[model samples]
Target: MNVPMLTTDFLDRGVELYDDVTGVIADDGTEYTYAEFGERVDRLSNALLDMGLEQGDKVALVSGNTHYFLETQFAVQQLGMVFVPINYRLIADEYEYILNDCDAKVVVADHAYADEIQPIRESVPADTFVGYGADRIEGDWHEYEDVLQSGAPESPERPDIAEDDDATINYTSGTTGDPKGVVRTHRTEHVHALILAHHMELVDDDTYLWTLPMFHCNGWGHTYAVTGLGATHVCQRAFDAADTFATIREHDVSYLCGAPTVINRLIEEYERNEPETTGDRPVRITTAGSPPPKAQIEQVEDQFGWKLIQIYGLTETAPLITTSNSNRRIAQTDRAADLKVRQGSATLSTQIRVVDEDGEDVPQDDETMGEVVVKGNQVMDRYLNKPEITHDAFNERVEGWFHTGDVATVDEDGMIQIKDRRKDIIITGGENVSSIEVEDTLYDHPDVQKAAVVGTPDDDLGEKVTAIVVEKDDADLTAAEIEQFARERMANYKIPRRIEFEDDLPETATGKVQKYEIREEYWEGESRRI
Candidate 1:
């Protein structure tokens, strides 16, 4: 048995076995074998070194899900450098904050995002700024292709790294304001990769399609795990429902991981028209950004015949901690409908608990609610430069638990059902109400497609309940009708005092309804983070 020490080991081992096979299929139809991928990473590593980039230095990669993004990832790890993947959607100041904070010595940007990088050029003091893709823009940056050609096509010596050595710094999307840097170690990455591979049932035969942005927790660590298992990667620069369907048919993608929103969009397209595929079809899709509705889950199975496994985790948790894998109990049950509701049990390497403020364990009696806590190798090392936050995140007095701000309950069968984020809980007239519960109830309605409940301002009550709804096409949904539906299912206090109908709800990059964004209007001038 061989123990893995480097993240780059995935490509090295993959190429040795599947050197000639198409390992990466780009959108432009460009294919790269494992051997070619390894060579590109080696050249990228050598190029960084030649540009005077030292080990442990920060290198920022700003792009979507592209082959170069994947190459830069392994290259940074090979040279013992920290790969800082910046959110391409982030505004100039946000990008500037990341660059200035990380002090990145090199910035590898996507050519499509040239406008975003142009204004911020003066802010980055890196030795090199390489732009990927075909075409040249007048700038001080070097072409991505030119850099690879300038350096030797060989990987530098692997870094003498300990298990605790920092590998990457993932900037988490903040619901309130500025993004926080979550530092992850190589051990955390390696362990999480193995955990994801096992939990998601990833094997050598699996062909993964990248639908989620790679900037997001390294696409929930699928980048390494897929390669580790010698799985082919169908890389897409950007996500489109049509393109996604076409790729699934073209490559016969066996597995993919994305947010619930991605699944919803695909399901919408699928319902409009059935897609025909000639090759291997996708068998599984792991979703985690937000818990998908049961209707969406059923649609995935009914339409594409794919097993939609729901997972839950954040960028801080190395992205894969708990999953809703279908078990024998579900397979044998008449209630496949009920099983989809629970986010399910923890993975083999993950230990999950629902604890109270006192840090004692909450009862496994489904009715009891508590804050969800986890302790695992997948947990992040710390929040970079935020010791206070890091300290709060990893508390030792409560039996050394990493406090996940999520509130949840565990059923008798040991299934963990997340209720809501601790901050998202609503308190009206001294009563604690779960917005998710209200949202769930609203989702049960026939006309409702998407629902987000937020605590709005109220002179009488401390905070009034408000629900924003998106009605299905051609479905007649009025505020009075929705109010009546909520009134029957929920307590009068939990019912929305105000209802607003929208064509679409504001969403995060991952498709999670930015409840915070919706709540912001109601919470104008308020000092609270909620």
Candidate 2:
């Protein structure tokens, strides 16, 4: 008999098997068992039910890595209500667009970020406002604790949720235009969590630390996987190098996820003041958002004694389709770092192909670059209210597979290495250059702290390869020296013809270099060709 696979199955299993086990450790160090956590979720569901919320309604949350954020996810989803988690780093105008776009009926925000929503509260469609710390917030909001107290702790009446029912809507960064809501169903998220749990080797005895934001693809789907496995969650309010190390020791955190920017901060902190890296348990970190430098990965493993795993995907794809965590392949080669650096082979039941413009799969040469396309259960159902855009995204280049705008190459072992973003690829006079290739070469230089390569408008070469670099402290580097260093490493066309030094490069909330923002500065007058 085929039963509907719902996201609520995770929490149901957790409560049944590990009711007395510690389920969550809040940011402020408060601990709650699975029984207590399940009751709180039921209470919040009843509260929303009393507020006139029904099935197919939307509940938006703006919170940090807190216990309530975890509670809200299950609470709203259990009632067949769609959960919308907004990026707390976004501004008022962005929040306004999202709230109105989703037609959120109730908005639950953290005290620290409630002000951003307060200014535009009246303009949005939301009727009820709830704050985690309502006393500190200026707006007229119901306290989160009071709302839970108002409802009964028993299970609220649940709707007949199907496998295809909408589970959540995660918004893209919208660097180019308005952020698009990626609508995912219960089956997509449920399957993705199972795949992730298997690939990450998650176990009930593991302790997970929340260094990544909960809003980011539902904390990369860890909110479900970690809880479903009956593991402990130690939430950190915000990412701090000192706090990360201390928390790892204090809670014996076994696993966590972060972007490359987070890894850089930890490396810098380790260099400045050496700290104990782990507690009694071994530690493992998963990095994504951008390809991390080899040096950083080595430093994390060798210096910090932590395992680093690289994953690849976007918000639209349930945030995880590939991971470079193969022990079998790594053991066969002495160059484990090289294999670890690549966005390794596809995860179980996922099909990944690097194809040329003609929609034909490229050879596994590891040199010929092509766009990465994928077909998997984890892919989103559609972009909400954007049918035309969704059709174009899926139909473009290939018929059914989702086109991942990332240009990459597949090795003989089917290991895919991302070259550059399709828009970020630099086209000189006649040849195409990968900006990531150039940046990776620059990172090899000891003096180079950070680098971003962009194509600048040029009359002769169509577009000249340019580099914006951040040098190490106390290092006085010259543009000529950098060019000479590039000459020894890469081809003449791939080398940055123009180099500019900067104190620091602009980064996104996830720590990716804002290349589009950097491109806007250089291509002020003329439109960039690529």
Candidate 3:
């Protein structure tokens, strides 16, 4: 008999087998057993049901690495509702677009971020609003605790959810347009979580730290994998270098994931403060969002005595298709750091190929750059409401394969290393910023006539968003003023870090700005363009 896969299976197993175990530790030091966690999820499910949310309805959550974020995910999925986790860093307008785009019936936001949504609540489709800390929020919102108390602390009646039913809608930044909702089904998320758990080497006795944002692809699917494995989740509201170290010691955290920037920050903190690195247990960290430099990897493994794993993928691909955590590969080489820095070969059952413009596989000599394409169950079902774009994404370069739009080179051993991005998206500090979006904001400035945005290599952040602009005739504009203007319009991460005045931008015969040529000047001696 074939069994239908569902995301709720993770939490169900935790509740059944690990009822007495400490399942989650809230950011505020509140610990909940697996049974308590399951009941809370049930309460949330029943609460949403009482609020008129039916199966397939979308419930958007805007929060940091909090327990409620995890609870809401399992709670929503268990009842066959779809969960939409929004980036807490986004502005009200950006949230407005996502909340409307997903057609969320309910929105649950953390108090720290509820202000951003309160102003645009009327503009969104969500009829009900719940705040995690309602007392601190300046709006008429239902308190999360109150909402939970209003519903029964028992599992809500589940609908007949199929394996292909929509489970989550994660909004990813577009290359040249608005954010696209990457639709993931129950089967895709369930399989991805299982694959992630196996590759990350999660165990029942392990404690997972929440240094990474939970909203980021459901904490890169760790919310399920870690829970399903009966591991303890130590929540941290946000990633602070000092707090991360303290929490690891406090909770005996054995595993965590973060971007290269997080690794750099930890290194900086370690050098400055020399805090205790780990508890009795050895710690393992997985870095992605951008390749960690060799020095960072070495410092993490050698100095901190922690194993570092590098992974590669996008929001559209369940965010983990490849990982550089092969123990056998490292055993053969003295230069283990070198291998760890490269986004290694495909994970179990995931097929990855680097192809030239003609869709033919490129030579795996590690020097020839090609666009990376992939096919796997973890891949997203489609971009919500964007059929044409979704079709082109899978059909381009190679038919039936999702084009990653990432330029990479594969070594003889099939380890893929990313070199550049084919799309005009700047991934600065693990956040995607669209060059076109920033340019449009720059153009709104009366003094700005032409602007080109590019990603410049940074030692800390994998890439820094840089802007080159030509001011209007006789119009003087300072970089600070332009940055301030951008700050008011877009998210802080999307704001250009470095702005340069230019006489004119280089263009091709078709009058399209030659961004590749413009970016070459900034990445003069860098080994990689991204």
Candidate 4:
């Protein structure tokens, strides 16, 4: 009666029930049915086994969104080998640090990025280096296709994997110093997918566009969720507005996930092309990272006629704890635009609490800010080789609750609204200002496009509110005019004292504006970052 939950369960379900259905749409325009994809996974599994990779051994992969990365996920999980998915956007040094940190047994990288790995080839513990889908591979690099072809297509013997067996070691983009690997067991990964599938309404007929990077929290664990439900995966190697819209139209995509940056790009593209909706069916765009502005959300639904399911989480929580799905009642009323801006309620099987510094629950007034802590089966087991950090993550003040490091509020309706990250909150003249609040106001301006707000060191005010603005083409917006716009809408202390126009702002791979990067220049001589 007690069967084990496993990441491999997703693929097994698809193979048994939907073998004939198209499962994957590769970036190269190649298609594979569930049956065909299963066979490929089988081949890769056998090849890994044949090469002496056993359960618990780490297999590292570095690449963009590609079929090879997806296949490696299933194969590595099936054999009970730990999968280390490195962020491709990281530098060669960063990549080397991860490889050495994890002591990867085998390293698989895209051929295009082979140069990055070459410098630290000898230093990494990985014995075998596999390359996929590129010319001019190193002489020692094993071809990904060759390995798949070397083994028989028959399914390999399943390893004795349990629900709690080690699964993935995801490296977070380091904000402090070295990146730490967040370890998730098979159970966590499996349930995280199911929870996501439930909230996103993933069905067999739905097709998901791969706008989010596969490397990011395993595409927010949708890689397993969509695949398990037998939904078609329309993979795009990179996130491009033209290609994304085209993929949606071509594949009749019903669902997708992205951050605010991706949504903004699509909005820009949609305006230029005026592409038709994805038929009469509802398309869900699940956004995470920084919350979207109300105007942006309204424009997405009004102009593009697609639904937005905004979510919030981190790599530590298997990346999903809260989601704001489109509610018909709210959408029917004038409050729909306002609701779109909130992070919504706790997801199914997840417990969320907004607690003050003392670990006491914050009042549900939607104004009292506190840190968001979450508890659920989907939370990661631990940070690999990071006992101290893991211990600190589950702060003892609130036992069993994982501290999220985000400052937010809970409204009367149980909606969790994020004010800002704990570090991003700007303190000017002894008053705290939510960067998100100012950014939302900036988004309201007709001429402004993407915006980011950060605190700049000031002798008089301690720190002054600074704004970085990327304006719409041909729009002559000045710092004074922008400051004037904010003054009318918010407190004078909260309004940006300085504004700088730029072609674009620097963003992390997942679309989050890197405020720390922006602060480097301003705080160069200061001993303290704050």
RMSD of each: 2.1, 1.2, 10.7, 1.5
Which candidate number would show the highest TM-score if scored against the true structure? Answer: 2
Q: Any runs in candidate 4 off by more than 4 Å, and if so which?
A: 175-177, 326-333
Q: Where does candidate 3 have its weakest 10-residue lDDT segment?
A: 506-515
For residues 1-530, write the lDDT of model 3, one tens digit per residue.
Answer: 99999998999899999999999999999999999999999998898888888888999999888989988999899888899998887789989989988999999999999999999988888889999989999979999999988889867888899999999998874433467999999999999999999898989999999988887778888998999989999999988999999999988889988876577568768977999999999999988775555767778889999999888988888889999899999999999987887889899879999999899999989877789999999999999999999999999989999999888889999999876566666888987675755775786676766778898999888898999988866788999999999999999999999999998887421123567777778889988767
Give the whole-model CA lDDT for all candidates, comma-separated. 0.82, 0.91, 0.87, 0.87
TM-score, every prediction: 0.95, 0.98, 0.82, 0.97
RMSD (Cα, Å) of model 4: 1.5
The better-scoring model by lDDT among 1 and 2 is 2
Per-residue lDDT of 435 in model 3: 73
What pairs collide in candidate 3?
Answer: none
What digit string (tens of lDDT, one per residue) describes model 4 on residues 397-421? 5877898889999988788999998
lDDT per residue for candidate 2 within 1-530, as digits (tens), equals 99987899899988889999999999999999999999999999999999999999999999999999989999999999999999889999999999999999999999999999999998999989999999999969999999988889999888899999999999987655578999999999999999999988899989999999889889888999999999999999899999999999999999998998788888878888899999998999999898887877888899999999989999888888898899999899887778888899899989999999999999999999999999999999999999999998898999999998999999999999999888988999989998998988898898888999999998999999999999987899999999999999999889899999999998766677888888988787875455
Give the per-residue Cα lDDT of candidate 2 at 450. Answer: 90
Tens-place lDDT per residue, model 1, 1-530, is 75645676676778788877777877677999888988888888888888888889999988888888888998898778898998888777788888888888888888877667778888777756788863665577788988987779766787676667788999987675688999998888988988888889998878888888889988899888888777888888889988888888878888887787787778667766777522555478888876677777777776677887888888999777787786775886675646776788888778988888888888889878898889898899998889987887878436578888888999887788888888788888778888888888888787787888888877677778889998877898889999998899878889988999999998767677777888778788977533
CA deviation > 4 Å runs, candidate 2 = none
